[model samples]
Target: MKIIDAHHHTWDLSVFPYSWMNNPHPTGDISHLKNNYLIDDLLEDAKNLELIKSVHIQCQGGINSPVEETEWLQSLSDKQGFPHALVVYSDFLREGIEKEIEEHCQFKNTRGMRYLLNYINNDPINCFAPKEALLDTTFKKNYSLLEKYNLSFDMHLWWTQYSYAFDLIKSHPNILNIINHAGTPRKRDEEYLSNWRNGLKTLAQAPNTVIKISGLGMFDQQWTTDSIKPLVLDCIEIFGINRCFFSTNFPVDKKYSSYEKVWNSYFDITKDFSIDEKEKLFFKNAEKYYRI
Candidate 1:
């Protein structure tokens, strides 16, 4: 089947600074990813799959202007054709959002933008964007720029924050909100799953919000298809067929499984579904949402 990888990233350490990659990732050490991962590397990673198109998500903290990544990705797309769309980064609390957002949309392939709202409530010392980012008044005002520019947002936050997330989405219904990492149900415990599913159910109530089932590998040290299958299927069950899609999360998720193994697992989980149903989950829904 044709695939539109809805979330993945390609980075060149030589071109831009990625401060997050340099340090210890919350899950563990990801210093191994500090090296470059260009289009050639991505193609190599997905050799046997019918990988047709993809969306390049913003991959680092905004040490510099967020549009810098967009400019770089635009140039890359000018040469290499794979990342048909981009979800660049933006810090909503910052001033000059109007000016910078205008610059971001100048690129033909720019689709949306993402700001990491994954905050540690208890460990406020470690929080990057501040614990109250989504709830902050200034950030809320600036987030409206997405609607002004007619751009989507790739929202990546924990389920615990969905109460505030709902308020944010309701105020900006015009902005397409794509929830990343399957609500990021990091803990496999019963209580965590309950909260994750509940948060997702609330988000699904808003027609503008959708979810991407990626990054499940990080949930377990030694993950398996059966382990993640329920989470994958749960997202679909909540969002229904049209409002959700699967993504590889690519080289970042490479720690858990290969491109083939990941896609094969998705196929294995939904083997009984109709061909058209499979098509939407795999490619059709993503193609429509990202305007591919």
Candidate 2:
């Protein structure tokens, strides 16, 4: 099948510092990802799949100097035919975010912005932003500016923060919003799973929001088709096939399994669905949402 691989990452440590990767998450150890992962590595890893297109979500590039990574990716895109879209990073709460957004948009493939908001107060390891940063007045003001530049929003947050994320999306119906890492469900207990499902259902109520089915391995490191079937089905059932899509979450997800294993698991879970549904989940929806 023609695939978009909606979300993945590649980085060259020698170029610009991936500032956040230096910090260790208490539960998820990504220390192994310190090596250089360029377009060549991604192509080699995905060699078995018909990977026609891919989206390069921000790889913890410097907060203030995120455009530097986009410029670097554009240089790669000029030569390599991968990462067809770029989701650069920016701290929306920071002053003068508009200038940074303008600079990022200068690149031909710049598609959107992702501000890591998966933080809880006192939890430095897992939290990327202040626990309540999503509700901050200044942050909301700066976030709204994305539409002005014709850029979309890609949000990464845990299930606990979905209410705030839901409200934010409801407030801005004009901007295209994508939820990253399957809402980043950090727990799999009965209660947590229940809450994650309800939270996903509520978030999907916002017509503008779409869910990217990636990173199951991030939380469940030893994932199997049986283990992930429910989460995958629940997201598709809630968002429907059109508003839901697949992503490799590569390099980071590579910590758990090979590229072939991750995509194979996704294909297995959806094997019974119609071909058109599979096509939308794999590529068409991403192509439309990312405008790649």
Candidate 3:
């Protein structure tokens, strides 16, 4: 079967500072980092893995610099085999942000916006926290602009903040809201599993919501395809294959396993699922959600 990786990332490490790369913690050691995994790099990985397409989610290095990043990716789209869709970043809290988003839409492969609410006071390195100003009326007003443009919102937030994402979606039920990284699951904490499952259930009930099967690499760097199978199956049970899709989250995930291993993990997890379900999880859901 041909696979379509719904979420992956690429970066020119020199262009921006990915501070998390330098963290001294056990999980932060990035000795495996590689250079220039651009179009050709991704294509080779995909061809090797039998993946037919991919969607590029925004890298943290270019936060709030949506235009420059989109243009760079656009250049790649023009030059080589880029992701079928691009999810770039934007500050819904900023004034005239809709205009910026409008400009982004003009790009050939641009598909949606990623808010990246990962910032915690103690963890300034991660880009998955919600901005404090997101709750402000002004910000919500700007967020409402997404309805006008018919764009989707890719949310990168911690499991604790899932409720906030739910609330935002409830307010704008007409807009498409995708929860990234299965709400960034932390399996080591057994207590968190039930809560995460419940939260995922709630998000699944929302008519306009979808979840990405990505980012397990960040939580457990040494995790293998077998190690993540149970959790992936659990996600399939709760969200259903139609509401879920697979992503590599490469380079970042490369910290844990190789691209081939990550792709094989997804393949293994869905091996028992029906062909239709596998297709939806691997490709169709992403195509419909991102309108690729």
Best by TM-score, which number? 2
Evaluated at residue 248, the lDDT of candidate 2 is: 84
Across 76-95, the per-residue lDDT of candidate 2 in tens digits comes to 98899788999998777777
Model 3 over residues 1-292: C-alpha lDDT tens digits? 6677788887777666655455543345566654656777777766676677778887655544667778878787777766788888776656777778888888988877787565445655554444554456766787787788887888776666677667878989988888888878755577888888888888888878888888887878778777788778878888887888888787667657778888788888777888998888888887888887
To one decimal, what is the Cα RMSD in angstroms of model 1 from the true structure? 1.5
> Where does model 1 exceed 4 Å of error?
61-64, 124-128
Q: Candidate 1: minimum summed lDDT over ten consecutive residues — where?
A: 123-132
Against the true structure, whose lDDT is highest? 2
lDDT of 1: 0.85
Task: Please list the C-alpha lDDT of all candidates, in the order they appear.
Answer: 0.85, 0.88, 0.75
2 or 3, greater by TM-score? 2
TM-score of every model versus the real structure:
0.96, 0.97, 0.89
Write out the backbone clash pairs for model 2: 119-127
Supply candidate 2's per-residue lDDT for 274: 97
* Candidate no. 3 TM-score: 0.89
Runs of candidate 2 with Cα error greater than 4 angstroms are: 62-64
> Residue 44 lDDT in model 2?
93
Over the stretch 1-292, how does candidate 1's per-residue lDDT look in tens digits? 8888898889887877787776545667676677788888888877888889999998853446778888888888889897999998777778767788898899999999887888877765345566678888778877888887889988888888898999889988898999999988878999989999999999999999998988888667477889988898899999999998999787788877887888899999989999999999999989988999
TM-score of 2: 0.97
